[model samples]
Target: MSLAPRIVLVHRTTEYEELVARHGTHGQAAFFLASRGRDIEEVAERSRRTRRALDEIAAGIPLTWRQARVERADLDRFLFAPEDVVVVVGQDGLVANVAKYLAGQPVVGIDTDPGRNPGVLVRHRAADAGALIASAVSRAGAVDELTMVEAVADDTQRLLALNEIYLGAAGHQTVRYRLGRDDDRGAVEPQASSGVLVGTGTGASGWLRSVWQERGGGLVLPGATEERLVWFVREAWPSPVTGTSLVAGHLSVGARLQLTVESDRLIAFGDGMEGDAVELVWGQTVRVGVAGVRLRLVG
Candidate 1:
């Protein structure tokens, strides 16, 4: 007789008792439980239930708890087995860690964002709670050896979205730059003043906010609906005027035209990531593109 296919269920906390209770004996499987050392009590309780269920399902089957050496190798073992299925239960951070460890595998994450993880099935608690959307966007470019997955929202169909990327300064001050083209390629022109901002639909919310805040916190690009655009300014400054006065001054850009920041401590952040120090001068083209990789997910 052929044995049932194996499934590996990974739980982060003790609350996953219900999960083990329901699906523990449904098939031939193993349970891998771990914790980030954040909540010990929860981990203890969950570990007990998970072990009980696993023991009940398959007598004398191996049960492994969180150990130092179980890092990526253990994850690889689960994936290399064609007869095995890995189910991860945790938040986006935990999901990302597992996905990174598994890299290329027919694995799935439960209750987390599926962004940046290709060829993986992601189920979100938002979907289980009847929310209309269940999707995570990764502005942090592509990783090696992965492909995009089909996404499924709560009570919605599966779909895919393009990757979004961005780069910007860190502080509330303005970093000036010029706009033009590079080798016939449309690029920011040669100039200096405050800072520059480049972003996509996914990154607009993050990098865009810094620029917006420096520009007196008004609507960005008043008449432009372009989702992908870069802003190059020669000068920027934080508003010091009180309430309505600042609003009035912000609405009237006469004062902003003369204000400029002069500091070499400017930093670049992409997808909310603070990058290493790299010299950026006039006419230097910082290329941002829709990476040739796609991320996929399943309900």
Candidate 2:
């Protein structure tokens, strides 16, 4: 007989908890919120709801299965096995954050407040977590294999993104880089732009959508499950040293985007988490392509 699968619960800090941690006390947090005309009771109520949801989900996990709980902030340090079933109980972004850390593990996204926060990723309700967990463990659940984007530097430092990867300067300054692709070798052009955004089909409605809309919607983006990626250059500037012709394009299988850094420093980040990024200096080459792994999101 096979052993029970380990269920890992993932969550994020509540607004009330963050306030208290920053202010050092509940009373101080309340006062700080009041000064900004925000009600502390509302924040407290949200925290209560989150705790209730967490408790209900925990109670539903089978006692026979091994269980573990982790916060989003500590996901990097958390060791996840291939057979683990990850249950994320938070907003949609929490699901995206956890997806990168996983290889092919099944993930169940539980929305704490479904009514207010309708999400594409966090589709399951807290009340249904028990059934979902059981289904996932038995490998009988409906799974959505979502495409992911990956960025690899010259040093072999790789980062996976569920939504998109942003590459540019650390600040709001214009970034200088030589952009090219695997298909077009000698056609590489020097670009000075705000940044470059490499996104997947799952990210079409996110930052990619905004940039696409701004450009008057010329390109047709891929679907959430499509094995393709879209890239857009934000505010590409045309100068004597830089060209803006290669602003946006699509990347299919066997096609990869390459960037040779000409700036003093360029930062690459995934899922809009700028703080957690990889730094690339001058002469470094980074490749963006469709990731080999896909997110097995339980539907």
Candidate 3:
């Protein structure tokens, strides 16, 4: 390791920022929200809290060590160092947002609004940043190596997600793809569906659980660090051209879910970040599985 590991502080744009950006000015955004009987102050207050959290985290960094602040929008364009310690300040989703971009760096998740967020990934408060940063840098902290999911395209392109990886249509219409498990090549089923979702145990509490509940426990989900993965075909349409027999299943360790495109084009996105996705066309294939790499989270 380097004599002084760099600290990479990651955060996402706030709702207030998004509103202003969309409406072209804060006054216009406030007017729009006020017209709907919503107070813009609530949104602005959240941004202020986030800003304070950022300042606290930045203050915690030792002057002798190198550091960098990264926004969520620019994660794809940013490069991380091997000896870096990542500190993400935002909601639990932000942790998922940054997890895909990391390798094995230890991450410190700080909750800016613990009361409203009810976060799991972010276990610490902004006020605790200094001590947590010290412990992590000194290798005196305990880290939970959370399992993740990965999707590898035929062309060798790969995408990772801490929560779940989704393969579906870019729009609301159903997508056409052949789905199968790696071990059972003979059971490949072609179907028309909204899309497919392959998720980690960390994702069970969110979108994955909804699917599981809606189907009355069709597939059992793994735990956060479990070496297993689960997949489901959303709203599979039954027709002469498509079948719904292979809708849900689990991927054992090292096993993968195979997808062969039948539509003109389909999209593969991870952790609900549709903006950054892998584009798949007819006849293309991608494999989804529990990723070998894990997220080292320091609590």
Candidate 4:
């Protein structure tokens, strides 16, 4: 008989939990929120709903299948097996957080509150998890392959971002770097900018969309499943030492955008998660490209 596939349920901390963790107590959190004219009960209600959804999903799993529950914060330390099916039971950002850690594993995005939260990534309700789990285990579910972006530093430090990768300074200061494309024949342009944004098709609708809109929609981005990626340089400042001509472009499959850091410190972060990132000092070269692995998202 074939072995039962392992199901990994991923979630995030609720507002109430975050408040309590910050303030050290429920009463202190309530007092702090009240001072800010926020009602603690609203957070409480949201937390209660999330708990109910989690309970329903837990109960729906079959007795024969092995199960594991993990929080978004703990995903870096979590070990995901080849046969594991990941189920993210939170907002769309939670799905992005879990996507980088996975390879070819099928993921089911379950929106805890479909009414309040935009279910762009998390499109399914908790009640449908059982059926989805069965389909995933049997490898019978329709999967949407989402492209991902990767940033590899000269030191071999690497990061995989499901949405986009932001490369810039640690503060709101100017970033100095030389930008060049792999296909460019020895031509590189030094640029001084606020930062650089490299986004995959999955991130086209998020940060990339806002940037594209600000530029008068001149550039048409690829779809979420497309293997192509778009990049933009934020607030590029032109000077004798730097240029702004190479500010935006597209990266096809197997193509890479290279940057040589001239500043004292530059940080590279993926999917807007700054806490989990890599730091590149002066004289380091980082390459941003399309990652080989694709996120297998189940509808």
What tens-digit string does per-residue lDDT give for candidate 2 at 1-299?
A: 87678999999999999999999999999999999999899889888889999999999988889999999889889999988999999888888899889989999998887776658888988899999999999899899999999999999989999999999998958989999897996979999998999999888978899999999999999998999999999999998989988899999977899999998999999998887899999999999999999999999
lDDT of 4 by residue, 270-298 (tens): 98889998999999999999999899999
Which candidate number has the best TM-score? 2
TM-score against truth, every candidate: 0.34, 0.97, 0.96, 0.96
**How do these models rank on TM-score, best leading?**
2, 4, 3, 1
Alpha-carbon deviation at 96 in model 1, angstroms: 7.2
RMSD of each: 15.1, 1.1, 1.5, 1.3
User: lDDT per residue, candidate 3, 76-159, as tens digits?
Assistant: 999998888899999999999999989898999999987887678999998998888888888789988898999999998899
Model 1: per-residue Cα lDDT over 1-299, one tens digit each: 64443444554443344445654731211233323234334544545644543333233222331111122224434343333434454433334334422323333444432343332233433223111111111112222222221222122322222221222245535454333322334422333434444332333344455656776765553221222333434243433421111111111111111111234443443332233223333333343322233222223
How many pairs in model 4 have backbone atoms within 3 A of each other, for residues 3 or more apart or on separate chains, i.e. clashes?
Answer: 0
Residue pairs in collision within model 2: none
Residue-level lDDT for 140 in candidate 4: 94
What lDDT score belongs to each candidate, Candidate 1 first?
0.33, 0.92, 0.91, 0.90
Give stretches of model 4 more than 4 Å off.
Answer: none
| lDDT, residue 112, model 3 | 90
